[model samples]
Target: MPNPPRLRATALTATAVLLCPLLAGCGGDDPKDPDLTAQKLSWKDCPAPSAPEGGGAAPSPLPNGGRWQCATMKAPRDWSDPKAGTIDVALIRVRASGGKSQRIGSLIFNFGGPGGSGVTGLPAFADDFAELRTRYDLVSFDPRGVGRSAAVECKNAKQLDTYLQVDMTPDDAAEERKLLDGTESFNAACEKNSGAMLPHVRTTDAARDMDLMRQVLGDRKLYYFGISYGTELGGVYAHLFPKNVGRAVFDAVVDPTQNPEQGSLGQAKGFQLALDNYARNCVSMAEGCPVGDTPQDVKNRIAVLLKNLDAKPIPGIPPRKLTQSLATDGILQALYSQELWKYLTQGLYQAYQGDGKVLMLLADSLNGRNENGEYSNLIPANVAISCADDKPRYTVKDVTAKLPEFRAASPLFGDTLAWEMLSCSDWAVPGAAYHPNVSAPGAAPILVIGNTGDPATPYEGASRMVKALGKGVGIELTYKGQGHGAYISGNKCVRNAVDAYLLQGKTPAPGTVCS
Candidate 1:
């Protein structure tokens, strides 16, 4: 399951028939680069990412009959001004093994993260979509300012250490100031280092980029598989190009209707439910459990642990100490999947024993920190794109005002999720108006999948998405399971349904449930 990216403020494609009408602006006369049109990609051998020391090379995620090769495409920095400037788009494709006889065109993917790197993530998808790849080119790209694409630069790894451990639950004026200061400092670094790309990275622009990808890739129609934030992109694309949306699948759906604060409230409750599920399992274990006999008791114990950390952080893993903020992130990360709950339990157990290394490691994994103490640009890119797409949020004072309301919504995680979003207030650019309404009236039926116990994008949002896209073209499938993403979960029925939709534009009747 993809980790839910920490929230903030603000923040693909094609070919053949000039498939995107809206991407070129109204009447399709926004701008032009005749030279950029009709260019075919020159695919080359895939570049290998660095592997861990003594661990040898990481196995390629490419499935049988597929060989990975990559290409670069030039996209307009501002679609409205094709001549103003351009950005290099990094793309990876695994050509269909069925050859020309059975080819169905390219199937693009966006694995959430408003910041997840497509090139680095392609292999796992390649393996998962192996069956579909037999008849389609499996394609994905890091959106502008992300991953292999020109990344959004911000704080250095060492410089970012202290920020992660700040007290996010800030119990007093001084603690709140520290939290605000840390986010403000991080924002300043991003603006100073990545100002140029920030404005151009909005979701609307990214949607336009998808159309450019389609035109260049030679696909007359857009076919995609988007999870989490990818759903946000795909949903926007559908609104813009309803007629061009061929077959799109969005799982672990993130609702666009909710404002920033509402989004946080919903997610906090989602994680709280997931944590309760983890707690239930933990309490039932044969040996001693870290907390108490029930979920509330577990939460009480967690409160004590976080309170203690705020008073005195454990000196952990040389050069980095365990702070309450990092510990909260660590716990949040584990809440994504039950498979990782074991690690959360272990981390909590170790923490209670006066060591914070395990949870710190989990936070590092969620933040994309490497074993070498170096960090990926995931956090920076996530913030950049999110701030560009979302509505502006409250400051420390404003957020504090909403604490009572949020706390009532999620007693365990309300504060952190709400305050973490304050980072958006320091964004370098303004956001597009929040999309409270999303409907693709003329688009093909879009399948919206949700995991009942998902920690990040909760089940209710899936129902909301279905209602918003309710013009007889939205299909909702439910997974009664525990995890962040259902498609990748261990449910055969869910997998088959997803595969069927992607392969044949077929969706089971709405309200289909799989356990």
Candidate 2:
């Protein structure tokens, strides 16, 4: 989602940097129910889920032999031309526990991937909806080009391994060529495998699908809880159909004003911050903490390990070696949440002892790579969707020239993310219009959640979104906590703020900070 190049490691925690890319709009339309044709949805018992975390990369499919009911809704591939073709968008619904009398509305949920499968991830948040269960039928879907929907599949697991292992920090023309060739190859794989849908899966198109879902559900307005890249989709929906908005909370805001590189650079800084945080904690603990005696010491050790692995990838599992890329990926995965820092500590200890298997496995887990090397399509879908939505403002030459700044952002992760920006430079399809500005002019007050110590989206981005949104005119709720997102990380203050906003149509005062 936020990390367009999914292979790039996100240190500190999980889910990558979606809070870093997703947006808002104005109001002019009259307030009345939308009168549009609605489609009927077939309901049945839901199926079981293959994996809850989606291996941190792709959304695992719903279990073929499980409990959750599943259904399909069709939308024209090209909304502009309904005659062109059709694609299926998958949906999973948890009917309100309360009788119809208690039902307030239908709340649509999106778990930030730009590529992450909302349908596959439906169950995890089933509990998040616990309080709203009686009042809302919580529904989530795999946006086009993901999960049970028409997915974007590029390299298979093995080929993906080949592509990901390519050196991100290229020092010579040969390395640069290898990096470009890998990008070209991965892009070509996507083109070859997912060409048809690639052209149609723009964020705007997905927003249109949301409108259709709203109409089909027989609702005049939309109630949504969007996280990370989901914020992108939600923000876009608000802009496109500002009048259709109901109660919405965009937790972990993504500054839609930022282009790909700027967002990535910001994320680089966030990861650096997370790394420093982790290092400080690790050093303070001393024993069993492999990072070192001080934050600088920890940082240098990490750089040394990456350099060593880059020169010589150590043996990992039988077939998979721990390359610099995988090692970095493992590190980044830990950065997504503070909870994973312990695992990072253990992995680093093993890695320092010459056993990279632990770190490599950690990387695999984040990328949704199963033990058998069966990779999930999350990365492929992420690339496809992100490329469709964004085109780099800088040329490949420009990106390379900007390396110093990227490096200056985070010595541990700078180039890894910088090189990743090249994927769209030679994308198979041209991207949509560039600028995304969301001032949500006439819409009801919207809540933008920001974690003060968030490593992915960063706190200032939230403040920026609110300012563009006209400040309290476009509200912001702060979580003075650590991690990529605050709402779902057991922070009652953040959760209550979100609940109050969605359930009671309440907005916290501007600059309200929750610890």
Candidate 3:
């Protein structure tokens, strides 16, 4: 709700980065309400979850290669009072078969989103980290309002269907008014339906929940592996309980203090950087690129393509529902992961040929619209989390004033991106004050990773976070790469450096540049 692109990853929606007054400004439930406390958990009391009733054999290896189990542990909704109301945190545990007792401990993985499902990612890294798992239990969970846990379900998935289908970026005043009205309407719906849960969905609250999860897991100190917004979570934990931290790896880190407006501008620039990287590998090559050699050339072509689609929404594959906006959404999604850049290039290439199928598929995937016409809860959760975390900075006048600058920076994606949050400006749940500095002075050495050309979390952000921590080390694994949160995905030099730190408490030598 805040700006879609900026708040997207952090706030449940991954819109844009938004900063606000304070949790108190969220305005719903009383902050002093004793019932809403986040209670910390203790290991001795965190009973091991029950296995499946049938105790059937394990399933086949997963795409990322690992076996997974549904596990649960109880923690109080509020940590300050352990005796308060308890909630069950659904977890996915992937144990390592090779390492055995030498296991270092459990490593909790959070993939940002304040809503992203780390549980679903367990298998993706299972095979590669088999050794690590042998010694340590790899755990991921559905943070509150996320997957599997007591999810905050929006109106029947059908309404969400309608929500995702709406276009937020409009060209004319009439369309613009429609976009603004739609946003306020959606915000109202969430507030009325979600009730008290709306105000309590902040990152700070989520971090507190993580601390409780840590205690329930029975770890004296916490070890974490977080990506994107996950970095914020780890930072918050380190800040709250530095002494309780063990080994923390924050890849694709973000500086929570940044203003969403400036950050979005910076991100647009970062996207340009990534686009340049993609062009280097894509344009002027034998394979062929979707756009032309010059980045401006590509921008011009996309603008044309979007206009064509805007005038006539192409019927995409059955479920993706290919609209111009959806296509843009897909392109942005793939931009987050460079591995998919080729497909985008191919899709763009094909779209230039009047075949919107590939682009539509890519877009569908980005939109998380399944083949069955059912979308993953990604978009809605993205909105819910973001709106709850922060309010949008609005005023038709303010956004209009910045239009020229934004458009100049991003010819193709600028105006659309700028207007992506007309909905959150009037959001019922506003944000709390922005705390620029969130550092863990006494926490164990926290490892911060940054790729020089990361399309998502810019390199500067990682640098800022490391500097702010003051005690932690920033490992510049110059993959000289593009994409988001793929540490341990591949790249031996980078993987080994991270592996050594997690496996053994060895931090990469200062400013170590791997690969």
Candidate 4:
């Protein structure tokens, strides 16, 4: 579920532990220093962006749906070494939908992936984000290694399939060997296929690309909305070019300093926490709830069921086979959205009855498996980006040493999740592994938002980011509900507050708590 990684603060000590050396990189120079001049530009005075030379005047309306047009911008591949190679960024703009008089310049949005596609995000959110669209043109583009732009692609699907097939929770040496060997093969393939682009896909490089997009749009500043992993990109942007940031919102922010090794392990714990939440409030209910009284009971039952599936997987299902592994695979897929919680309930009901068919369907969904035996491009893209962006601070021995803690933190999925990082163990590029202090000297303090009950991005992540930014205030918006990405999801208070901030340059009062 960690498509990309985002912001927030908390009341509890939240236990910010450097518990592992892998998680130890967050310790560095404090980066909070605001730029007063940029902060002073009220929403009214913000400059409007002009169309690029090739694109037509007046953002055009599209036949299919949301307005779309192509635009291009130039940026330094490495900002510090300004004379470094130049990269061309391709952009797609969706003009706002409200009264023309109320039009604002641009509101750039990112779909969370250290390498996610932002090209179609605006259109996807067109209806839900009507308010945001009215005043500002929703702008997004392919970050380096993303859509319609020069993307980083892996040509070896077979090797990747082997890695994906590896047992997430290896029970013995034989399985472990398979995991290690598959990992190495995938790594070799990436290195062999992706050369220079692999290293450059890091979150920092993507942020620099955004700054160039701003200049191309001809806006003196940027109005942004970043979710999940997009939050980290936005944070790095705020840290590097604060002067160019206008009213920015980072919802579900990841602490950039926390690299993938620690972050994924921590995420394993977060997922278990979410499972606990679902078991408590969702399971015992009359309609769709899956479990018998206790959360532990449900978990124990699931374990037994998975063991059975592993030993004797259901028979042939065409090109893609369904085994005990795929049944458990379905469970992980159901965790992505609360909307699918009912599906989980139903799958569990069937699973308890020893019917693995339904669960296989669910797993197929999660694994990006389609009905025609085809798989989604998401996983391939995910592996490439995640492996590239995160530094494996832990070695195989390092991971083994922490098994006890991982298990304690996440019994059902921790070991599997922890082992997931092995994908990068054999990666071709030893990523720069540099975590910079992102607080720019003169950037406006961007609003970092977090939801209390988000399953994918734990509330603690937001708290860590808000605290790290030092000066920026953390706005805790209690959805008191479920699902990920809550900003445009209809919590009136949250929406109104966000709208006011982007449209009027208003920051919710310090320590603002919205429910």
Ranking by lDDT: 1, 2, 3, 4
Off by over 4 Å in 4: 1-66, 71-88, 155-162, 288-293, 315-317, 323-329, 351-377, 434-436, 472-479
How many collisions between residues are there in candidate 1?
Answer: 19
Model 1, stretches more than 4 Å misplaced?
1-32, 49-65, 286-291
* Best-performing candidate as measured by lDDT: 1
Model 2 residue 323 lDDT? Answer: 88
Q: Could you tell me every candidate's TM-score relative to the true structure?
A: 0.91, 0.90, 0.84, 0.80
Model 3 gets an lDDT of 0.61
lDDT of model number 4: 0.58
Q: Write down the lDDT of every candidate, Cα atoms only.
A: 0.73, 0.72, 0.61, 0.58
User: Root-mean-square deviation of each candidate, in angstroms?
Assistant: 5.8, 4.6, 6.5, 8.8
Question: How does candidate 1 score on lDDT?
Answer: 0.73
lDDT of 3 at 150: 46
Q: In candidate 4, what are the lDDT values of residues 1-515, reduced to their tens digit?
A: 21112111110000000000011122222122222112221112111121111111233344435646665555555544546565666577766666579876788987664444455444445555677877898887767666445555553344433444456567787877776776666556556665666666666667766766665565778788888777777777777666677888887666556655566666666667667777875655766445556777777777777777667654434444455556655666565456566777777777676566666676544443444444333344455656555555346777687788778888777676666656667566664553434554456767777766665566667767776665543444444545555675477878887888888877787556676
